[model samples]
Target: MPYDTERFDGDILFGHNSLQVVYFYSIENIIRGWAQHFRHDASKKSFYHVDTAIFEKLWRWARRRHRNKRWQWVKKKYFPKGNGRSWSFSGEVEGKRVYLFRAGNVPIKRHIKIRAAANPFDPEWELYFEERLVYKVKETLDRQWQRWRLWKEQKGNCPVCQQKMNPETDWNIHHIVWRSKGGKNTMDNCVLLHANCHRQVHAKKMTVLKPCPV
Candidate 1:
């Protein structure tokens, strides 16, 4: 998603994780534009939800020339899942696998984010959403969700102080059973703690409430 790389690739828009897109592009245009695009070196493992139409076209074209089984060699390698009706585009390009991701597949109410920007009157309204807003919103939500889940696992209280814990403040994932005593690195064996509380527990100044299931 870095704009500084002189972004391009057919109708494909490049985004995070070396991505590409082919929204509303004909197969011919997609291929030609991608081949001629600048900054070709930056994209290597293009992992994203690619247009399925591209795969459909290739399948049809190959079916005309070779046996169906033979043409499916690459497909089989990439999409070993059942039925192989994948909603993504992934394949090797000059010994490198390129991926394309579709924004529509985002399950977290993709429509809300989409329609919020799809103002037909001013098409570029979405682009004018201040600076780095999309990244900020996504990151904030993910962090909040992570913090809440951690607090919930601690049964809503700090074991050492036996008081309600706050997920909003600085916290640490402390091991309920110390790793040195052969504890497994897992949620069941872990507890969330305030940063100060964690430090005191590790410093052996405060004893943690042990056998505090979950």
Candidate 2:
């Protein structure tokens, strides 16, 4: 992620929040959105095909990082050269196929925003989008990123109750180790749950396991 240094004045620092912008391909992501049926196939091989903009940006970064290196060295180390032909990156991962994809593909069509200043307790900030086409951006982009990460990690099921969580409404993040106890905000420390299930866990009615199983 790039730093907010005076409106695009700072260096473009890549990989600050890499997980937010890079996604693994899943049935939920293909077909412009999610499909009703989806599963990970371990037999497939890993593949990567980035856009032109991404390719250029990465090449520029590589060049800057390896200022004294030859162009051939840069190409060999940075870009993928398969069969001495295809420049797209691809490989085998433990005899299984994986993919690295670009981010921010989720749709956000027509919508409305409201900031109710009178509601002191909540501020009543809200956004509404056309259900069939758009997503309602939550309070923060980090929240949305976490939602997508958890959704992909758990395959859209709440670990607490083993139930399907509503994409737009039901899911919530729970910290395995609380921030007050020195828990850092990372995938390993966070788990997704339904809002009710979250309450249940807090009430001692349920438990969540680290490295949550699907």
Candidate 3:
């Protein structure tokens, strides 16, 4: 793809993870968009009446980086005068017809942020939609505190086994009510349990296990 730095901002860089806002379009949609804008039969050819000016601009930009003699030779061979309408070679090379149009890029502001905090345990990433809150997740949590909260909510141990679990990898934060059963993403509707217990909750095979703490 051709890079058009003139269309985007100097401060904002384009592509993934950059603080730039750009509308991404597929090549197909780009062709359609250009045809609509220029009022041309996009299916007819690789180059149209409007392509000469755009290609001329592109050639000027390209000549700065390429050898003048080679560039002129290539230009003369491919970009001849008065033959702009039948310039398409997509069918010969790609086994299909292709359409394209003159397009430009524009810059946008960053909506996501990642930062470090004094509490290394807290989540450091944030995402915004139109400057509004979306959601945030902590990469790690204080297991004792998390367990205490779950204990208070479920009254101790795995509700399926009434057995205490190792606080770290063995446990999982589980929804108290099935999500499909109208459970909400709130603390009151969630509890911590052994991973096995969580699976049993889903499998509905907890009958042989001890009942939850009363």
Residue 5 in model 2: lDDT: 19
Best by lDDT: 2
**Cα-based lDDT for every prediction:** 0.45, 0.46, 0.40
Residue clash pairs of candidate 3: 21-108, 46-88
Which sections of candidate 1 miss by over 4 Å? 1-7, 12-147, 210-214
Better of 2 and 3 by TM-score: 2
Which window of ten consecutive residues has the lowest lDDT sum in model 3? 125-134
TM-score of each: 0.34, 0.35, 0.29
lDDT of 1: 0.45
What is the lDDT for 136 in model 1? 44
- Model 3 over residues 1-214: C-alpha lDDT tens digits? 2223343222222222321122122322443445444332223233333344444543453344345568555454434333244432111123423322333221112234533332322221111110121111222243345456666656556766778665444555555554444555466666666667666655562322323446
Q: Give me the displacement of residue 166 in model 3, in angstroms.
A: 2.5
